[model samples]
Target: MHFLIIGGGFVGTALACELLKQAPAGSSITLANSGGPLGKGLAYGTQSPLHLLNVPAARMSWTDEQPDDFVNWLAGQGNTCDGAAFVPRQRYGDYLAVRLREHIAARPDVHWQQLQNRIDSLTPEAGRWIAQCAHGPALTADRVLLALGNFAPACPHPSLQALPADRYVGDPWQPDALSGLPADAPVALIGTGLTMLDLLISLQAMGHHGPVLAISRRGLLPKPHRENELPPPQWQAPAGWLAAGSLRSQLREVRQAIGRAQANGQDWRDVWVALRPRTTALWHRLDERARAQFLRHLLPFWDVHRHRAAPQALAVLRAAQAQGRVQAAAGRLLGARVDADGLVALQWRARGGQDTQEFKAARVFNCTGPSTRLAEGRRGLFGHLLHDGRLRPCPLGLGLEVGAGYALADAEGREQPGLFYVGPMLRSQHWEATAVPELRAHAKAAARAALGC
Candidate 1:
């Protein structure tokens, strides 16, 4: 039976690799990705050495069963760095590419096709799925895995919503979005996440001297890397706190638990490491109300603590703040209109019911992160699937609805055969599906289900 994986990011690559490792010889597998092969997507395609991974190298293996896989590959390439160190993302991408190439070279019996074409839609025919590529002819596969990763950011503000291309920088991942701006033009960064940091680095590299205004609801910044700390041994949290208690109370208890760990000379990273395994379980325990409450009230705080910046990147952010080049403020955008200068005019309300203030940005960039609502987008195969009743979105609209085994559900919420989702697209169902550890496990499980093993 032929297997088709849509997307060529880390999850897709790892899935393809794992299938080849376990499946019988001569198995046909086709990986359809617009960018082709390993490091094809945005996360791995970046060339900046300054951009480091949030997780350390030790925790970023392709599989938990193979703990030292990535580090060993890096070592084989004559890299003498410490195994636990957080390496450049570019190096990680290179490692993935090297492994993919080695696997392809060694697997003579397996036919792996890397098609550099986007999948426009998926149609079911004769117990198989037909994937229509943007340019190439359609290919039929017995099983299909949707491994598509990140989506473009969703702008929530009207000032941002009605922005024209000339007055906005829609996608921060593309470096050219910041190109050709006047050297001294005042710029506005919509969110203060890692993507915002990336744009800051790009601007600094280009030697742009304009003041940057980064505004968010809380103006929260990512915590910096804990570099000097050792590889933290796992520690246990208060039992059942994350599951049966209120989120606010649980957070307080967790804060107290961290204090206790620190008193014992252990770092908070240990607590974080321990929580990683139970995050999904804890998230699942929360009801819809609790989940929504967490999203509304605790998401910003959780994100700042969860996704940290590299030490080097943190230093840049700190230095910029000290120099007054970067301004982080908390406010809600009230209204936005176009001015005579053809720029975005924004009204914002400050913290604690302060007076509304007006600001005009020569360029307003949306770094608010990925769009979770699939139906909101004009393109993508999932939208088409939803419209045709092939798939229904999760209640939260975060992704396609799926069952426990990651099997795609129909419009009536019934499980569908031969269709599976294996990455961040399952975020609504599994909050922890976005990263490597969870993704690798999900890929393995999906492979097992697909192969009937």
Candidate 2:
């Protein structure tokens, strides 16, 4: 069997490793990426020492059976960290690269190759999937995995489009996006999430002392993980809460659980940890309207609590805010234009008010996170897939529609055989799919299913 894994990031690399362990002796695997080292992707590709993994070392292993693989590897490299330690993301990237190389060296019977190019299009032909790359010969495989990872940030607000290209940045992951900016020039960031935090840290490292502003609908920043490990909380769902089958009811139950935990002097985060295992199932139980309500009303609150920052990283961000180096506000961008003095003038309406205000900044960054709505201006290979009816958008528009065992589903709800996906986008089907623990399991399962096991 020959398997082609596109976008050789964390998901693709994990899937390849799983295939190596389970496929037949003569199986072949090809991992393709446009640039950067394998397995780094956007999240792990950062060179900044300030960029740290949100999760602790103990739970980052790619394989469940080897729970300590990452931490043990750290020790082998003369860096000792306990399972609870939050390490730099670059170290995790190095760990992934080393593990891939070692796996290839040990499995001499399996053919493994890496292609440093982008896949431009995919075509199904002759019972196999053919992937055409931008600068290489096409690859044909018995199966294909679309580990495309996160999408690039969408275009910024229409008003911001009038600004000079150099004055605005749409993608934060670009290596030089933050380079060459004036140290004293004011800057505005368009999102108040993890991406904004990353840019803030990078700017500080670059010695940028300019005033910074971050704007979002809610102005909510992610909470920090607890510094000390508490015993895992033991909690149970209220009787018949799941059976009630209402999103609002489920949320109320969760709030009640948190209240109970607080009353008992236990951290509310422990309740969230205890509830992790049931999140996907609970999401599936909701009807379409209830799902929509959750997204409209509760997603912001859930996101801040669920995807938290490392304690160290959060401390730095809070310190910056306390010192007035950074400012965050709840608002919506109205528009932007370059002024006579060469500064970009931004207009926005603060949340809960109708009046508009203006702010001048030398640079503006659109860090509003990845665009998940497939029907809205999707370009490149994914757009092609959707256009050709090979992939369907999820009902909630969070990502592509996927069926049982990670199979790609078409517009009419038919599963596309031999085509699979493993990424955070799987959140369309599994609400808790983005994190490492959930993603690693999906990779293993998808590989096993693809190999007919």
Candidate 3:
């Protein structure tokens, strides 16, 4: 058997390593990615030391069986850090790369290959999948896994279209996106999520002393991780709450749980942590309407609470806010244009205001998070798959639809055998799929399925 894994990010690398451990002798695996340090992806590729993992080192292992693997590895490198410490993301990336190399060295009987090229398309022919590369020879494999990580952030404000291309940045991950801008020039950012925090930290590291404006609908920032560990909550929702079968009821119950936990002198984070294990089951129980309502009304609030920032990073952001170097506003961008003086003019209305206000900045960045709608403006290999009717978007537009065993499903609800996916897109099926704790297991399961284990 031969396997082809695209998008050599953390997930792809983990999948390859798992296959190496489980596959039979003579089985081959090929991992392909556009040129970059494998396993880092955009999240861990940042050079700034300020970028820290939201998750603690203890829970971020390649596999669940060895929960302290990351911390053990850190200790081996002479870093005397505890399991609960939040370390730099680059360190984690280094760990992943080293783990991949170790697996490859230990399993010479299995053929391992790396292709540093982007896949342009995937065509099914002669009982195998043929992957066409953007700048290399095509390759065929018995199984293909689309491990594409997060997509680029979509431009949310239409007014940004009028601004000069040089003055507006649609993707913050691009190497040259921040180039040419003066350090002291005012800058505007679109979202107030983790991505926005990362950019702000990057700017601070670059010695940027200019005013920064961040605008979003609610302008809610992520909460900070707790400094001390609290006992995990043992409370469970009442059966009546679960039977309500509505998103509103579930939210009310969650709020009540937090209230109860607080009343008992327990941290609310403990309650949330206790609920994490059951999140997928609860999400699957919701009907389509209930799920849509949750997305529309509660997603932002849930995101900020569920996905928190490192305490150290959050302190920096709060310090910037206190110093007035950074400002966050709750509003929407009505429009933007380049002024006669080459400055960018932005017009926006507050959350509950009729009148629009204007602000000018030297540059603007779209950090509104990755686009979830899979079918809109499809590009590259994913676009080709959608165009060829091999893939279809989930009902909530979160990602592509998949069947049992991570098999890609088409619009007609037919699963495509020998084709799989293992990445953030699994969120459509499993709401709690993005973090390392969940993703590592997903990658392992997908690898087992691909290899017929």
- lDDT string for model 1 (1-453, tens) is 799998888988888877877777878988888873465467877767777777778778878898888888878888866665878888888877777777777788888888878888988898889888889699899989888876788875755767777678778877578777887778888888888887788778778888888888888999876884345475676656566677778778788878999999877777877777778887777788888888888889878877877777878878999999888888787877778987678788876667998778888888888876766744668778877787776666566678777778888888778888887878777788878888999999988888878
Q: What is the lDDT of residue 181 in candidate 1?
A: 84
Candidate with the larger lDDT of 2 and 3: 3
Prediction 3 global C-alpha lDDT? 0.86
lDDT: worst 10-residue window of model 2: 228-237
- Residue 330 in model 2: lDDT: 95
Clashes of each: 0, 0, 0
| Candidate with the larger lDDT of 1 and 2 | 2
Cα lDDT over the full model 2:
0.85
Candidate 3: misplaced stretches above 4 Å? 229-244
TM-score of each: 0.94, 0.96, 0.97
Candidate 3 lDDT tens digits, 330-357: 9978989999988998888999999999
Q: What C-alpha lDDT do the candidate models reach, one value each? A: 0.80, 0.85, 0.86
Winner on TM-score (1 vs 2): 2
lDDT of 1 at 246: 72
Query: Model 1: runs farther than 4 Å from truth?
Result: 238-243, 263-265
